[model samples]
Structures are given as C-alpha cells and as structure tokens.
Target: MWLYITIGLVALLIGIAIGFFIARKYMENYLKNNPPINEQMLKVMMTQMGQKPSQKKINQMMQQINKLQKK
Candidate 1:
C-alpha cells in the first residue's frame, strides 16, 4: 500500500542522513589527526619550485590551509 511505501521512503532518508553525518565526522577526525599536507611536504614543494621556504612562511601557509579546511 501507499502507507508502506511512505514508511520505506522515510526509513531510507533517515539512513542516508545518519550515514552522511557519520562519514563527515570520521573525515573531520581523520583530517585533524593527519592533515592533507604537512610542513615537510610544504618544504619539499617549495624546494621543488626553487624557493626556500622559511619557517614563518610555512606557518602562514599552514594557518591559511587550516582556515580553509574549517570553512
């Protein structure tokens, strides 16, 4: 019946919402523990580009990256 179909749809939606939240939380935690890029990687990239990355520059870049991720 139509009532059964409605209940099934509702259940499916609830499952999807729960899954989304769970996945989002997991990714946030993973990113916090292991950032996408680290200071070493940044230095490597800068060196590759023929630029010596200073500590201040690295910290600035890290702050910017963190801000972006938070947004």
Candidate 2:
C-alpha cells in the first residue's frame, strides 16, 4: 500500500510538470506571434482618460483602440 501511494505521488508530480512545460511552451510561441491585447487596452483607457499624447503616438493609439473596440 505504501509503495503504491509513493508511485501514485510520483506519477502525479510528473504529470503536473509535463503539463506546465507544455503550457509554457505554447504560451511563449502564442505571445511571440500575437500583439499584446492588454497594451492596446491600456492605451485606449489612457485616451479615454484625456491624456494629451503626441500626434504620432495618438494616431497609432487610436488605430489600436478602434480595432479593439470594433471587436
């Protein structure tokens, strides 16, 4: 009974480690190809809060904001 319990614990730990490894790799690749949504959201919130941004940054920010708002 004790041996069975030890084997079960080891298997559980190995499974958890494998799951975390796969998830981390997937997320790393996913983020590399994807634009960060939070940054765009923050820019939109800042604009809504009425901050005076420069012309170029404002245009870029507005574009992202519009794109997100459309979705």
Candidate 3:
C-alpha cells in the first residue's frame, strides 16, 4: 500500500512538472508570433497622449520594449 502511494505521488509530481514546461513553451511561442503590442498600437497610444509618433520614434520605442522583454 505504501509503495503504491509513493509511486502515485511521484507520477503526479512528474506530470505537474511536464505540464508546467509545456504550457510555458506554448505561451512563449504565442507571444513571439503575436507580440502584446505592435507599432500601430503604440502609435495610437502616443496619439491619445497628444504626441505625434514618428516612424523613427516608434522604432526606437519598439527596440526599448524588446530590450526590456529580453531582460
């Protein structure tokens, strides 16, 4: 009885670990393909804040965002 209980607990723990990794990988891929924010969204946000967003400015902001995400 004790052996079966120990085996069941071990299997449960292993399953949990594998599921966490799989979910994490899926989300990373999803986010990479579809970033949370894009240039258009950024431009709209800047416009709403009363700033005229230039292409160069948008590019710079995107670089900064990518840098932060990498960290």
Candidate 4:
C-alpha cells in the first residue's frame, strides 16, 4: 500500500516539473518572437508628439526600453 502511494506521489511531482518547464519555454519563445515594441512605433509616437526623432534619440529610447524590460 505504502509503495503504491509513494509511486503516485513521485509521478505527480514529475508531471508538475514537466509542466513548469514546458510553460516556461513557451513563454520564452513567445517573448523572443514578439517583443513589446519596436523603433518604427517609437518614431511614429515621437512624430505624433510633434518632434522629429533623431536616430540617436531613437537608439537611446530603445536602450532605455530594453533596460526596463530586463527588470
């Protein structure tokens, strides 16, 4: 009886571990394929704000965005 109970518990743990890893990997791939934003969107936003964006400014903003996302 005790052997059966131990085996069931171990199986449950293995399932949980597999599920966690699969979900983690899927999220990582999703984020990699579809980031939250890009340069063109930033440029459009700045243009809408009535400021012509320079490449330097755009690059700076991109760095800031990437830094924030890392946190």
Candidate 5:
C-alpha cells in the first residue's frame, strides 16, 4: 500500500510538470504567431482607413482598448 501511494504521488507530480511545460510552449508559439498590437501597428491601420493618426488619438485609442480588455 505504501509503495502504491508513493508511486501515485510521483506520477501526479510528473504529470503536472509536463502539463505546465506544454502550456508554456503553446503560449510562446501563440504569441510568436499573433503578437500583441502596438502603437505602430495601430498607426498603420488608421492610415489604411484614411485617417491621419495623431499621437493624441493613438493614446486615446490605446487607453480605450486597454479598458475594454480589462473588462
């Protein structure tokens, strides 16, 4: 019984460690493929939309985006 219990605990710990590593790797790849938006990207987008992107407007949009994400 003691041997079984020790083996079970070790297996559980190993599984948890493997899961953590897999999840970390997945997130790294995901971020690499789809990086977070930045001011430069936003400026390009606004320009494409035919709007002149001013610094103040960019800051305001960034703040609004942050607020939405926080919710």
Candidate 6:
C-alpha cells in the first residue's frame, strides 16, 4: 500500500516535469521566428490599454526607427 502510493507520487512528478520541459521547448521555438513589437503595434496596444499616442509623435518615432534601419 505504502509502496504503491510512493510509486504513484513519483510517476505524477515525472509526468509534470516532462510536460513543463516540452512546453518550454515549444514556446522557445515559436518565439524564435517571431518579430518583436513595432512602434505602431505598441501604440495600438497602449491605446487599448487606455493610453493613446499622437500622430506627430508616432511619425517622429517611425522616422527615427527608419533612420536607425538605414544605418
């Protein structure tokens, strides 16, 4: 009885560890090919969060980003 309980607990722990390992690997691979956030996307997200960005400010930031990309 006691041995069975111990074995069951060990199996449960091993299953949990395997699940976590596979999830981490999957997420890492998924993110590696994805691009990070851009200015427009950031502004949109901020707006959704209740903060809006002005058009002039967004343009200025985009111009700076373009200049950086040209370098």
Per-candidate clash tally: 0, 0, 0, 0, 0, 0
Lowest lDDT block of 10, candidate 2: 34-43
Rank the models by lDDT, top first: 1, 3, 4, 5, 6, 2
Q: Provide the lowest-lDDT 10-residue window in model 5.
A: 28-37
> What is the lDDT, from 0 to 100, of the residue 9 in candidate 1?
100
Off by over 4 Å in 6: 38-71
TM-scores for every predicted model:
0.84, 0.54, 0.93, 0.64, 0.56, 0.51
> What is the per-residue lDDT of model 1 for residues 1-71, given as tens digits with 9 covering 90 to 100?
99999999999999999999999999999999999899999999999999989999999999999999889
lDDT of each: 0.97, 0.76, 0.96, 0.94, 0.89, 0.78
Model 5 off-target regions past 4 Å? 38-41, 44-71
lDDT of 5 by residue, 2-48 (tens): 99999999999999999999999999788657648778999999999
Better of 2 and 5 by TM-score: 5
RMSD in angstroms between candidate 5 and the native structure over all alpha carbons: 5.4
Any residue pairs clashing in model 5, and if so which? none
Ranking 2 against 4 by lDDT, winner: 4
Q: lDDT by residue for model 2 over 2-67, one digit each (tens)? A: 999999999999999999999999987786576565555666767888985456776787577557
Please tell me which predicted candidate would have the highest TM-score against the true structure. Answer: 3
| Ranking of all predicted structures according to TM-score, beginning with the best and ending with the worst | 3, 1, 4, 5, 2, 6
Q: Cα deviation of 23 in candidate 1 (Å)?
A: 0.9
Poorest lDDT segment (10 consecutive residues) of candidate 1: 30-39
What lDDT tens digits, residue by residue, belong to model 4 across residues 1-71? 99999999999999999999999999978887888789999999999999999999999999998888778
Candidate 1 global TM-score: 0.84
